[model samples]
Target: MIARWFRLAAVAVASLALLARPAAAQQILRDAETEAFMADMSAPLVQAAGMEPRNVQVLVINDPDINAFVAGGQYVWVHSGLIAAADNMNQVQGVVAHELGHIEGGHVIRYGEGMKEATGITLLSLVLGAAAIAAGGAEAGMGILGMGQQAAMGKFLAFSRAQESSADLAGARYLSKAGVSGKGSLEFFKKLQNQEYRLAIPQDDSYGRTHPLSGERIQVLREVYTVDPAWDKPVDPKLEARFERIKAKLVGFVSEPAQTLLKYPESDRSIPAHYARAYAWHKSAYPDKALAEVDALLAAAPHDPYFLELKGQVLLESGKPADAIPPLREAVQLTNQPLIATLLGHALIATENDANFAEAEKVLRNAIARDRENPFAWYQLGVVYEHRGDLPRAALATAERYSMMGQDQMALRSADAAMQGLKPGTVDYLRAQDIAMVSRAAVEQKRKKK
Candidate 1:
């Protein structure tokens, strides 16, 4: 799931409940390879937007629908379906640049305020409607959207035509400045044009409904590409290779083993083919076959951290935590990636050795420092603290986990317990106090509403 709370200063944590709520529960997908590829595509667009790449996160939602949107100005949620639908990395990058246009143009805030005023529904509700659309509850979401439209002049929360035009123009500029083509944006709109005619359900046409492709928008993009110098820029061969692997991996993990095998027959000896087969074998519960395929991958790219990480994941999931450690440790050292570090910590904790437990605590703490928004890291920290008989620390970690997840009541209860065990004025104690104060206020506010 997407981490509901964005990491800010500690002082900002207490104000979370007072901030806007999400439209629906977030279902975020975390994968090292996929995320890395997304980051690669996003970096140029983010830079072209005059924004810090670190400040903009590209999050993948697990839903299988062609949808993407910017929420909270910090996150861009792209459905896995969009990636699956894309024919090239540039197509995906075009979408990212467009969303960045929304962020850079400050359209989200302005459009949100306008929609709230026009529709008389909180922006959160509209977001929930979008989530419903993404989750295949199109009929339900359209009903909600229809209510908003009927309330006003059928505007609902969709972006105004002027705003869409501005975003399209900005997106083209960003892509051009980044030495990427506007062709992808044009092609995507062409694809949407086809969908607009073919798709029956309003909300089911996610990109069409949200993006609202127009002849003018398509014409404008076509003009931009024709005049822009970057239009003929060759696709980055390395990026294409990575995108292919990512698609292959996604198919292997998300598709049935039979389908995966059929797609990647034994005669296909390419790296991506082998990678897909490995995951397919693993998912089919044939660890030996999986290991053999992974070994082939390791032999080809001996130092590839993802391959090492995959080996560790396969071994760990197959109930060999001890054997998992060596590869996981190597992976962490090679990459120092937060996700891999967390996985290594999980393997360490699972081993249940005293020395391994202590090491796990250190690794988890470091991972949490870098990735504070990851509740899994905090939960693992709690597990480590509990193993070491540190109840106070464990309680505080649990409070943090619940707090980030927006579970104010549970956060308050855990924070209360933590505060009793911890000394006053310490960092943990102060954090616990903040959690308790904010969570208690939220609970009381909820009660008053009831």
Candidate 2:
């Protein structure tokens, strides 16, 4: 199921931007469940590349383009569209493995260096355009739109054809070492090639425009993989099923309800299809139907954490926080995922039951310890503290929440309030001081820009 946190974070511009390239023209999606799923699927490839799985961050970009790229250190940004468009697990895993190849080869640093020598018109205009897109998206695109198609493509295209071929070989090796077939990577490239052919007339210069592609790249990939013994290995059915469910979950939440229904109709009795329809029904205001569908799913796999989470989320959002507690608790127990634990904490807080207040505080604190970047968990911690009448601690938690949301001014205020009552040099006091310092810097930076 699509985590409610992502839906909430989507509308929050400042918070969302901070999680991504800060001031770059990229849209970074924040979804705990989706990210965890991607990480699980890509762990083997990352390990095979001799990289730490924890160090490699798999970020989702909220774009409809069929592209994946690596930027900065240990960051792989996959477009939501690519995931939704992928036919199976291997296709998506191939993309992940390919991007990992770029990282392992240190292509990002080399490309950045190459960009330094690109044509001035392309360089300056693209930088400014990216900033504009980062700052205001469509509203800011107006100024750079006139820069024209040439400048829209970033300087990273300066990557040599040799680099592309090298990445193809490296990616195939990683896949082979990880015991995964390389066929998906080949298929993905051909998909791009087919797209290039269809748009051969107008040339939609969106994604993959920077990457050098040629007939030889495909031939090289085919030649490299065809000889490997693992080339024809079948994709694991369980892994494939997980990918299908995730793709369906994303479509159910992001696509129009009518469209979702059309894609997964009543006759489609698969778990993923039902999962899709449950979300569609929930989104379309058919609450009873949504619950019914979820209940049916539970009948088949009652202990499934994700299914339990879906039930909990549906109930909680539909104004039954008290009712939402049991399944959320069960889900948390089964999965031990901090995301689900955080959701359960939210449900506990929403109930406003005096008896649940302490439990909520404990739950939120544990969640924050494990997933500190989650703004909602911090916010709920503040809510719990406030309910307990612990004003100073409440303010500190509020400050942390505001800091995560990129509201530095509010963070400063809350931190200052926290400092007034928090004990000197203690953990809470030190945290508040850190918040004050960071917020002061952020506020000053904004003022200077204006």
Q: Global CA lDDT of candidate 1, please?
A: 0.78
Model 2, C-alpha of 222: deviation from truth (Å): 1.1
lDDT of 2 by residue, 1-450 (tens): 010001112121211111223213655666556777888899999999999999998888776777777756887888788888888889888888877887899875675454444344544655666788888685566456444233423333333344555777788889999989888877877777777678672344333333455344577778878888889899988777788888888888878999999999999989989899999999998878999889988999988888899999999989999999999999888877888888899999889789988888888888888889887888888888888789999999889989978899999999999999999999999999999999999999999999
Show where candidate 2 strays beyond 4 Å. Answer: 1-33, 119-156, 160-164, 201-209, 214-216
Q: RMSD in angstroms, all models?
A: 9.4, 8.8
* Cα lDDT tens digits for candidate 1, 107-194: 7677655455544443444676688889999999867665544443234314454566677788888998999988777777776666
Residue 8 CA displacement from its true place in model 1, Å = 33
Which candidate comes out best when scored by lDDT? 1
Which residue segments of model 1 deviate by more than 4 Å? 1-24, 116-151, 155-159, 200-210, 214-216
Residue 135, model 1: Cα distance from true site in angstroms:
46
Please give the distance, in angstroms, between residue 127's alpha carbon in candidate 1 and its true position after superposition.
29
